[model samples]
Target: MKILIKMKSSLKDIVELIIQEFKTIASSYSILLVLIGGIFIYGLLYNYMYQPNVIRNAPVVVVDKSNSKLSREYTRLIDAAPQVEVYGTAVDFIAAKELMKENKVAGIIYIPKDFDTRVNRGEESIFITYAVTQAFLYYSSIQEASAGAMLELDDRYRPNMVVFLPAKDVLQIAAATPISVSGTPLYNYTEGYGTYLIPAVIMIIIFQTLMMVISMISGKERESGSIRHFAEQGTTLKRVSRIIISKTFVYCILYSIFGLFLAGLIPIIFQLPNIGNSYEIIMLFIPYLLATCFFGLAGSVFFTDSEAPILMIAFFSVGLVFLSGISYPLELMPWYWQATHFIIPAAPGTLAFVKVNSMGASMADIQTEYITLWIQCAVYFILACLAYQYNIKKAIK
Candidate 1:
């Protein structure tokens, strides 16, 4: 009977704290800014910037030292490729290099003076191509254009001299090439960077915004000595549990709306891949939001001032994006980094969200990530309680 009464009292305290927390959040303009502007407004802007995800017709300068029909043909074919354009012709290698240095071109195709002579003499010839490595996309476009032109030339020059052989042997020889290969970019059919990147980035934004806002609120409470007010109301566990529950409730409710906007509405607006089942996407967020809430609460212990979390955590956005394994393969990462893959909610959350939303994966396909998020929820919830308990004691002193 006494335990039941205590439970009821705790529930009542938590309810009261939830209302108080909402009022506090509404009053603070910064928290509202993060919850609204950072999550939705910034999300829209980032998606817009990446809307035309694939770069096409990147400019390149051609150095035609050969000045022969064969060299001119190769240049024309390269220019015809969708990925690159022959923006200008350079008289010398030095002029081509200057064009690249001046940002006039992303790549250079140099055909040596001996190119035609070597081809005419039935000797193997090499075409030297240089692409700016500053951006991988630039390099990729240049390589694709160069390879396409070379392949076309090879098909044209391939001798049809199989007449001496028997009919079957002739056919086999005619059909044979030095090598054959095909590449398919699955899931991301359009091969658009926005399609590949925006979904993962949206989840990371949710995680970052929640942490920054919650940590800032915690810092304000600590700095203003309001933590002691909660401590005075009950035992340490009661105070900590109530605080965690209250804060978590507010953020979870608020961020669920943001999450829906990010994972659902924005994708529709931008025509990004939104193939995931709506219910499955909603189910995925249950653990994701909880884990983020608890992690933010536990980490808020380090914030002495509201500005501290902003300054310290803001720079970690790029690191979080990399850690999510969107930019790199998880298999190639070291053991410690792989461990971090499970530890950080964003890593697993981003991967799972992409699988379901972009790749049309079912709940079973994301079982590992779903379970990992639940584990994070449990672990971080305990840590949050402990951190808040310690904060309460510190405030009392």
Candidate 2:
């Protein structure tokens, strides 16, 4: 009778608690920081990382009118830069243009009949060329890499083209003469702003929604003494466990489907090519999605008023997104920042997306991350179970 009276007294406070917690969550730092950071990342990505370093697979046809060893060396040097590939060696200008018209080659390099003579005489010689404007930035990088390789080869062969190349240009000297680079830029081979940024945004949605929904229910159940009734009624440990587990499973399935559609399927529908195997991407994320749901559920069990869980989630969401390299790549960040990123879930999550969508990677590629996610999931499930069984009773009393 006393317990029933106490319950009636507390019913109004429960409604107030839900409204207050919701209000507090709405104004939390995680929400604010995520919004601000999202804008910052978009601005930074366009202004910085999207700047092309080199074309991935541009076709370059060589016209050796000189038929000299020097022209041959130049051809070889240009072909090795990780961007340019030898389309065809043309006998003359007309043949090269034929290849270009066929779209078999992107650019043509014309070596005049006395190419070596001009260089040996220390005469300024223009290596005439044909490169149409196609994604000017990518073309420019290919041009620069080609030109840089030519000058470098000139130094090695001329042995005097640059007084400082061998001594002053430390990186040039240290790198192997034929040091190579290539871009197997897999998913979103186009690598446009939307293709890259949108996947990360999807991940943000997944992490946020799963944590929010799970926390809302778990926290509400705790403060309302529902957990105590379940415990006191001896609602059977198996059933109590099933309740949270079922909810967690539902959240996981819902967000995983939502994210997969947003990140994986939509890009393909929009014509973003080379977006890896859809099945592989969906399969890989199962463990990660599982980990996040339980991690948030565990947090809910520990938090009484919901304010702390909400705040913690908000902090982690923004912090994790930044650390994940969704906005800016970890490759460009300072060494210390790169080192710190690996510990965060966002790092692994972002990498997984890049691999599945961009790289055409299989299970072998993400084995380490898959194992990590499962291990973390196990840890969270254990903690959640322990908390509900032992800690909730104390908190309620």
Candidate 3:
């Protein structure tokens, strides 16, 4: 009977602690802004900015020194490509450079005077392309358009030797290339930048915002001396464990709603990729959220004031993006950098979510990331409890 009464008291205390944490978050304007603005406003703003997705008709200035029918036809073909448009012709390389310097074009294409001479002689021909170093999109668009035009030109000039071959052998010879190539893109059919990047960004935003909010709340507790009061409440191992649980519960519930908006509605609204199984996404998210929350709680020990979390965490936003292996492949990263993937919940979470959501991967495909998150959850939860116990002990001193 006495043990039952003790269990009831402990349960009541946990509920009260959870309510108190929620109230603290509600009353703080900074916490509310970071929680609300970072998730909704940032999500909408990023999607809107990248809505155009694909780069098209990037302008290029052509220097056609050959001034022949074939060279003019090549220029026309390049302009017709969807990736780039010829702004105009330049008489020489020097003239094209001036236009590029003026920012009149994204790139310059230089066709040598021998361009038509080489093609007529049935020899290989090459053209030089120059693009601004400021943005890679300009270079990519120019290269794709130029290469496509060159292929068409090559087909037009190549001899039709199949005509001399016997009828049966002609078909075989025509079909017989050393290798066949297909340029079709899988997963990202349109091959847009937004399609490739935004889904990963959504997961990253969830992790970053959750970290900031938890750290800010922890910082506020320390700054306002509220933690000292809480520390005076017996500071038992059991009580410290309950405090950690209460805090994690509040964050997990709030972020679940935020996660639904980010992972569900945002993709539908922006028309980004959303092919993952909803059941699988939820399964992945459960461990991700738990790991991130505890990761934040463990790191919160270092935050000296409410403002400190923002200062420290805001700098890591870009780092997190790169570390997530969205912009680059994880396998190619340096050994030391690759090791970080194991330490940061966002790294594995982003990769796993991208696979499931963007690539339509199954749960089995993400077993490594899924298991890593659970391991992090276990490890960080222990660290958070120990951190709070230390804080309470320090307060007693």
**The best candidate in terms of lDDT:** 3
| lDDT tens digits, residue span 30-139, model 2 | 54344334334433343343334235668888888887887788888888876778787988888888887888888887878888887766565557666755444545
Q: How does each model score on TM-score?
A: 0.77, 0.49, 0.76
Q: Which should have the higher TM-score, number 1 or number 3?
A: 1
lDDT of 1 by residue, 232-314 (tens): 68656757878898889999999888888888899999899999999999999999999999988888779878877887777
Choose 1 or 3, whichever is better by lDDT: 3
User: How big is the positional error of residue 322 in model 1, measured in Å on the Cα after superposition?
Assistant: 3.5
Select the stronger candidate by TM-score from 1 and 2.
1
* Candidate 3 residue spans exceeding 4 A from truth: 56-75, 85-180
Model 3 scores worst on lDDT over the 10 consecutive residues at 157-166
Q: State the C-alpha lDDT per candidate.
A: 0.86, 0.63, 0.88
Candidates ranked by TM-score: 1, 3, 2
Error of 3 at 265 (Å): 0.7
lDDT of 1 at 271: 91
RMSD per candidate (Å) reads 6.2, 12.2, 6.5
Candidate 3, number of clashes: 0
